[model samples]
Target: MGPTRKRDLAAAVVAAAVLGYLLVRATYRYFPPITVWTGMSLLGVAIGLAGWGFYVRARIRDAEIGVGRGRLHPLAVARSVLIAKASAWMGAVVLGWWLAVSAYVLPRRGTLRVAAADSPGAMIAGLCALALVVAALWLQHCCRSPDDAPPDADPAPG
Candidate 1:
């Protein structure tokens, strides 16, 4: 793989690690009841899905390069980046919705009095997840195939 592809793969690995750490830390810190477990589980699943998406995209890009397709157009690059972002956002929303629902239901269970008290760690974890998504997006934007030669400025030799 080229340097750009290597960088993207590295970024994906780092993002996954960060997201995992945040999820585990937040889950224990918050110590939510059974209902909140659903939200935590969703968050974990979202992180995993987003990470896999990043890996798949990176691998595809690498394969395209190996097959000699040359570099992708800027628009294609942008589209790939957008797709990764959308996937991450979808995951985040699923997790966030679960968290919201759990918060609403938890109060009725008479265990917690305020959402704010338990949300700091969860919010930090959410932010970490967002950061991971952004990292994947940035990596997609930066990748380029080595086969993409510079544009010609001179006329062709006879």
Candidate 2:
């Protein structure tokens, strides 16, 4: 499979953000307060993905350079690629959701006590979600073998 396209990711984020905004507008009163734990969870996942990406990059580099330290199994690389793809998509959706909540609440903070209270947590969650998306994309890049062409590279005619 090809690398994930930025256009596709952007479309997903926009679609999710619109839906999230509509949902929050309709039902935010029924929702619980945004909590620190939500942002913390996303931050934790981002950290884990970054760590995994570093490890994968090092292993792949070693193999590419023929350093003989160790070789990554083909299946392991495939698994990593799959996980990265899924995480990137999930993170984009989540980022959009949190961003929408932040957008809705921040502007109303002065008029609504609940909005004021929720603003900080929603913004924090949005930041963490952005981090998750970045880390997932990094992991996806790390999963690529050295021989793989860059995304912008033109293929040679057969």
Candidate 3:
């Protein structure tokens, strides 16, 4: 499969944002208060992904430099790519949802006590989702093989 495209992720975010905004506008009244734990959970996932990225980068770099100690496994790289792609998409969707929730609540904060209470939590969660997306992208980049051509480059003539 090809690399995850930024454009695709952007489109997913936009779609999710619109849907989340509508959902919140209609049903936020029934929902419980958002907690900081949501952000903390996402942050934890992002940190794990970042750590994996570092390990993969080192393995790829060492293999490219002909280090026997860094013998990379093809299956591991494949699994990493899949995980990174899924995480990126998941992060974008969550980021959009949290951002929409924040946007909706922030404006109502002064008039609604519940909105005021939820605003900061939503913002924090949104930031963590953004971090997840960044970490996933980094992992995806690390999985690219040294022989792979730039996404924008044309193939060489035979």
Each model's lDDT comes to 0.48, 0.88, 0.92
Among these predicted structures, which one has the highest lDDT?
3
After superposition, the stretches of candidate 2 with alpha carbons farther than 4 Å from their true spots are: 156-158
* TM-score for each model: 0.32, 0.94, 0.94
Candidate 1 lDDT:
0.48
Kindly report which residue stretches of model 1 are placed more than 4 angstroms away from their true locations once superposed. 1-46, 57-82, 88-116, 135-158
Candidate 2 lDDT (Cα, whole model)? 0.88
Error of 2 at 79 (Å): 0.7
Q: Which ten residues in a row have the lowest lDDT in candidate 2?
A: 31-40
Off by over 4 Å in 3: 156-158
Q: Candidate 2 residues 1-158, lDDT tens each?
A: 88888788888889999999999999999989887666879899989998999999999998878885788888988888888888889889998899789989989999999999899899899889888888888999999888888978889856
* Count of clashing residue pairs in every prediction: 0, 0, 0
How many backbone overlaps does candidate 2 show? 0
Cα lDDT of candidate 3 equals 0.92
